[model samples]
Every structure is written in structure tokens, then in C-alpha cells.
Target: MAEPRPRVWVSQPLIDAVIEPLRAQVELITTDEVTAWTAEQLAARLADVDGAIITLNERVGAAQVAGATRLQVIANVGVGYNNLDVEALSAAGIVASNTPDVLTETTADLGFALLMAAARRITESERWLREGQWGQWSFQTMLGADIHGSTLGILGMGRIGQGIARRGAHGFGMRVLYHNRSRLPEAAEGEVGAQYADFDTLLAQSDHLVLVLPYTASSHHIIDAAALAKMKPTATLVNIARGGIVDELALADALATGRLAAAGLDVYEGEPAVRPELLALHNIVLTPHIGSASLATRKAMVQLAADNLLAALNVDGAAARMPSAINAEAAFAARTASGDKSKKR
Candidate 1:
């Protein structure tokens, strides 16, 4: 009997180009319709699969990982891997990878676009015009804030944050202030023309504050009621990061009472369905999480993720095994030496 080819499952329908490269290498299973799958459904499909390519839609926590004992790798299609319990995957000896770097500039561009849209009430003004509400050219009919010469505050100073800061400083002549886990070196700061500020100072001084931090347990709802209270009443809030980073209810309250001037949200606490309160307000702008939605960028991201999947599954002769496996023996050794302290984090 011949050895069976590895079975691969793609959780969602991806661009044809992404899958075309994998077709000849494995027994591929994929869906044309993109929909959220239940845990049971995921478990059912995971059975007998050696590798899987998934998106942020499915929650691949401990249960799903444990059920797919034969599974060796999970190639996540997005930069954010919050949907996957990485610690659980690591413990299960499953290699998990994501598409990063490639989407950084594109996502940052969207973040800046959202900031400009929110500051100028772009969507609201368009709606008003479409409704034939522009009966007269009144001066104060749809007044909005100015972006240039304003203070742009950023929550996360990662690569994407630096990109936004560069755009603001160079393109818009905006003063940029950022709060990060650690300050960037002086040369890097000079390049972006950004100044490091404390969390409270960043919140209080910014004309437009944007969140681009990752989602972790410690970072959950980092922008809650107290954080909102710290910001300027006339400040605008823009979130292009993970949904759980901001408190939706508190944000709605802040926007409702004019505690904050306006908001531009690309990601919501519970996505696909935004809060009713936010929907009713005219001061906020909502998008369906399309930060990396440009045609070229989307294609590149999908291709990179497909490459990662193929590499992790060792499908192509040119592909390497999952990078995580290189350190797996070290992990096991450290676990034995440290009495299983390897999983503590």
C-alpha cells in the first residue's frame, strides 16, 4: 500500500490563487461559502486532517486543538492570531503561524484614512448630502475638526503605529505622540517625528487618538470608562486594532453624552453586529473591519498566508517545516529541566 498524502482542510473559501498552489500537494477540502463554524462542526472537519488553513472566524482553542490530535500546523490568514489559543497549541505540539509584515503598511493606511474620515465626519456628511438635506450652503451646517497641525496620539508603537505616525508627521504636518510598552530608540523616534508620552498624557493631549494594540488578557478593554474619562472631551477616538481592546458600552456612553467628540471604529467588541447605541449616533463612523481590504493588499495577504500554510505543512519541495518545530526539542528540554514551567506564560 502506498503512503496516504496529508489531508488539508481550509476553513473558509480563499482566493483561487491561494488554493491553486496547494491543490497538487495534498488532499484539499475547502468551502466556497464563508461562514462561522460551530466548535462541533470544526471538530468534525478537523478529523483525519494533517494540516488546516483557517482565518480569525473560527475559535481554535484547547478543545478544537485537542480533538485534532493528528493536526500538525494551523496557518492563520490574518496578522492577529487572537482566535487561536497559542499557548494551547504550543502545548499540543501544534505549530501555529500567521501572516504579518506584508499587511502592515496597508492596514496603517486604513487607520489613517479612518482617522481623517472621523475627524471630518465624511460618512455623516455624505449621508446628509444623499438625503437632500443640503438645502442651503450654511457655514456651520456640517462643521468638522481639522487634521493638520493637530496632535495624533497612538496607543501601540509597533511597526503599523510607526507607519501611521510617519504619515501624520510627513504628509499631514501633525504632531504625533505615542504610548508603547517601551520607547523606541532616538533615531527611530526622529525618523517618525513622534514623541513618547505617558498613557494619561497621550489620552489628555491628543486631538485624535488611535488604538492599534494587540489583544491579550492584560490588554482586554484597556480603553474602558476610566480611560475614556481621561481623554479630551473634544477628542476623536479611532480603533483599528482588535475589538476587545475597547469597551463598547462605555464608548457608546462617552459618544452619547458628548464625553468624546466622535469615533471611527473598524473593529467592534462583538464584531459583524455593532451596538445599537453606536448605530443611532451621527458622530461615529463604522466600518465592517476592512482595514486590509484593498484589492492588492488583500491578494498579497492571502498569498502570504497560503505560503505559510504550505511551508508549515511541508507540501512543496521548496517549503520548510513550521519554524516553531525547530525549537520544539528545546521546549521539551526546558520543560523537563524547569519542571513544566515552559507553559506558564
Candidate 2:
């Protein structure tokens, strides 16, 4: 008799092209629904599966991992794996992976688009015109900030950040200043025509400041009232990064009182439910988190994640694993240390 094929579960619907290869190799269980699962539902479904392809909506934390004793790998469809309790999964000896480089340029494009929309009041002006407010064109009817010859500040200098800088420096003829944990090498800096700026300096000097940082414990709410107060009052703020980096309530208040000129947001702290105040304001540009929503890019992301899943599950003829596996051993160690700290406290 032949050996049983490894069982794979897809938590959400993915492009058929991306999953067809996997289906051929495994006993596939899939769902067309995009809804999130309850803890009990996730636990029950994972009980017998050997691996899973999950998206950002599902939380694959300690509880789910504990229930899925046979599970060995999880491939996240998105670049950000914050929804996964990585440390817990690592400790359970379960390999976890995400799609990264594939979506960098596409996400950067959305970031720059949002920056332009916010600066030029694109969405707001369009809404006003649609509401029958455009009787006639008047001088300074809908004046907005310029992109060329302006300083663009970036909060994070990751791959996506670098992509945005390239567009600003080469395409728009804008000065770029970036603040990150570490500065890029001189060669890279010269290539992108970007300069390193301290956080406060970047906040103060930039005509338009964009956040492209990740969400980590250290980076949570990096932009609060104090940080916002340091920014130029006339400057526009754009967040294409994770929503936790900014205090949305504070941002709404600032925009309402003209403490800041205008704002744009792609991600929210508690997503799928935006603050009512932000929706009411005309000085802000809001979008559902579609930073990497391009058809080509989304397809690439799904394929990349599928590849990672196949390799981790040791499927024959699958793509190679990502060079960086997030260092599972290190993650376990960090979690142990955190638990010890908590116990002592």
C-alpha cells in the first residue's frame, strides 16, 4: 500500500494557479471563505492537518499550535507575520515563513500613491465635486502641496522604504531623508540619493513624512502626541506601514484642529473597523489596507508563499526555502526569556 499523502489546509481562498501545484502533491483542504476562524474552529480544523497555508486574518498562536500536534509548517501569504505568534510556533518546532521581496515594489507604489493623494487632496476634492460642490473653478479652489523639490522623510529603511526613496529621488526629483535602526552604506545611499536623519530631525524637516516601519513591541505607537508635536505643522503625514506605529485617536484630533495639515492612512491599529472621527474628516485620505493589492503583485505573493509552504513540508519539486527562516531557535530563546521575566515580575 502507498504511504498517506501529507494533509495541507488552506485557511483562506488563494489563486488556483498558486495552489494547484500543492494540490497535486498533498491531500488539500481549502475554503473559499475569507472570514476569520474562531479559536475553537481553528483548533478543531488543525487537529489532523500536517501543514497549513494561512493569511493575516487567522491567528496561529500557541493554542492553535498546541492543538495541531501533527502540524510541521505554516506559510503566511502576507509579508507581515504579526498575526502569527512566531515564538510559540517556533517553540513547537513548527517552521513558519512569509512572502517578502515579491511585494516590495508593489507596496512602495501604493505608499507613494497615498502620499500624493494626501498632499494633493485627491480623494477629498473628488468627493466634494461628486457632491455637487464644484459650481465653478476658483483660484486656490483645491490647492495642495507639491511633490517636486520637496523633502520626503521615511520612518523605516527596509526594502519597501528603499523602493519609495528611489521613486522620490529619481522619478520626482525630491530630497529624501530616512530614519532607521541603522543607516544604509554610502554606496546604497548615493544610489538612491538618500541621507540619514535622526528620528526627531526627520520629523521636523520633512515636508511629507511617511511611515514604512514594521510592527514590533519596541516600535508600537512610535508616533504619539509628543512625536506629532515635533513635526512641522504644515507637513503632511502618511502611513503605509503597520497601523500600530501611529496613535490614530491622536492623529484624528491633530487633523481636526489643523495641528497637522492633512494625513493619509492605509493600515489601522484595529483594522476592518476604522475610527468614526477619521471617516468624518475631509483633510484625510483613507484606504482599506491594499498596499500590495495589485493583481500581478498579489499573484506573485501567493506563489512565493506557496513555494515556501511546499519546501518546508518537503514536497518533491517544490521551491527552495527563504534564506532567512526567522531563526526559530533564537525565537524560542527569546520567548523563554520573556516568560522568565514575566514570572519574576
Candidate 3:
């Protein structure tokens, strides 16, 4: 009798060209629509599959994985895996991977675009024009902040943050200041033309400040009322990071009261359901989470995730070839110990 092929599940509707090829090698279970899977559904679906490819919308945790006896790997299409309980996955000996580098430049482009929009009042001016308010052009009409030769501050100096720094310093002739948990080396800083600053300094001195940090417990509500008060009142604040990083109510208050000049956001604390407070304000530019939404970049992300899923399932080689497994080492160690115990029994 021949061995049954590994069964894999694709949790969301993905680019067909990138995901369809997996069908030839494995018994593929796929969804054609974007489904909001419940915890019970995820637990039941995962119980029978050996591996899964998921997007950020699906949250997998201890309860979801409790009955997943045959599950071995999960490949996440986005860089941020806050939706996945990594600790639980590691404890269960299930390796997890995320697509990171492929989306860096694309996301950085969106961040800079948002900064320019907020600084120049692009979207707000457009709305004004659409409302027939541009019939007479006044000298003070839509006066906004300058992007060139201004101080650009970045809260997290990761790959995306450095990309923004390069654009600001080299392309726009702006001074770039970055605040990170750790400072970069001299050569790396020179390449991006970025200077390291303390967090408060980054807020007070920046004409335009962008947040690119990951979301952790320590980072939640990092930009609250107190933090916003530290910023220059005329500054532009942009957040392309996780929504929880900024206090939404505080941000709305600042924008509404002119405590801050203008703001732009791509992510929200409760996304796809933005607050009426933010929508009612004219000084803010809002966009759905599309940081890595370019066609080329999104395809690259799905392809990388497919590669990770295939490698982790040992489709062609050993289960250790996943390119970006977050917990590969620990998961493999746990699996090894479990196998040894089974053999002893």
C-alpha cells in the first residue's frame, strides 16, 4: 500500500497563480472566498491537516491547536504574526513562519506616501475641491507642512524604517532621526543618513514622525495622550505599524483640537470599523490596511508562504528547510524528544 500524501489547508482566498501549484504535490484543501473562521472552525479544520497557509485575519492559539494532532507547520503570509500564539505553537511542536523581507520596501513606500499626504493635506484638499470649495483659491487655502528639508523621525529603525530614512534624507534632503530599542552601527546609520535619538527627542524635534515598530505588550498604547503632548503641535504623525501602538482616542482629540496639525493612518485599533471620531475629523487621512498591498509584493508574500509551508511539511526534503520559521529550532527539538519517547515505549 502506498503512503497517503500530506494534507494541507489554505485558510483564505489567495492569488491563484501562486497557490494553485501546491495541489500537484499535496492533497490541498482551499477556500475560494475570504472567510472569517471562528475558533471552533479553525480547531476542526486544523485537526485533520498536516500544514496550513494563513493570512493575518485568522487567529490561531492554544484552543485552536489543542486537537490538531497531525498539524506540523503554519505559514503566515504577513510579516506580523500577532494573530498567532507562537508560544502555544512552539509548545505543540508546530513550526511557524512569516513573510518579512519581501514586503519591506513596498510597505516603506506606503509609509512615506502617507507622510507626504498628511503633511501636504493631499486627501483633505481633494475633498475640499470635490465639495466645490476650491472655486476661489485664497492665499491661506489648504496651507500645509513642508516635507523637504524638514526633520523626519522614525520610532522603529527596522528595515522599513531605514528605507523611509533613506528616502527622507537622500531624496528629500531632510534630516532623519530614529529611535529604536538598540542603535544601529555607524556604517548602517551612514548608509541611511539617520541619527539615533531618544524617544522624547524623536517626538519633540520631528516635523514628520512615523511609527514602524512591532506590537508587543510594552508597545501597546505607546503613543498615548502624554506621548502626543510631547510632539510639536504643527507636526505630522503617521502610523503604518500595528493599530494598538497608538491610542486612537488620544489621536482623535489631538487632531480635532489642533494640538497636532495633521495625521495619517493605515492601521487602526479596531480595523474595518473605524471610529466616528476619526471619520468626523478633517485633518486625518485614513486608509484600510494596505501596507503590503501592491500586486507584485502581495504575490511575492504568498509565494514565500507557500515555500515555507512546503518545506516544513517535508514535501521535497526534510522538514527543516523552511526559509523563515519563527520557532523551527524549538519545534524540531520538541518533536525529536517526543519521537524518542514514542520509540522507547
Estimated TM-score for each candidate:
0.92, 0.93, 0.97
- How well does candidate 2 match the true structure in TM-score terms? 0.93
lDDT of 3 at 171: 97
Off by over 4 Å in 1: 316-345
Q: Pick the candidate with the highest TM-score.
A: 3
Give the range where candidate 1 is weakest over 10 consecutive residues by summed lDDT.
Answer: 323-332
How does candidate 1 score on lDDT?
Answer: 0.83
Write down the RMSD of all candidates, one decimal each. 4.0, 5.0, 2.0
lDDT of 2 by residue, 234-285 (tens): 8899999899999998899889988898899999999988999899999999
Candidate 3, which ten residues in sequence have the lowest lDDT sum? 336-345
| lDDT for each residue of candidate 3 in 1-345, tens digit (9 for 90 to 100) | 756778999999999998899988889999988898999999999998989999999999999999888898899999999999999998888989999999999999999999999999999999999999887889999999999999999999999999999999999999999999999999999999999999999999999999999999999999999999999999999999999999999999999999999999999988768999999999999999999999999999999999998888777545457788899888878778777311110
**Per-residue lDDT over 231-330 for candidate 1, one digit per residue giving the tens place of the 0 to 100 score:** 9998999999988999999999999999999999999888878889889999899999988888787778777766666675566446564432323444
Best by lDDT: 3
TM-score of 1: 0.92
Model 2, C-alpha of 161: deviation from truth (Å)? 0.5
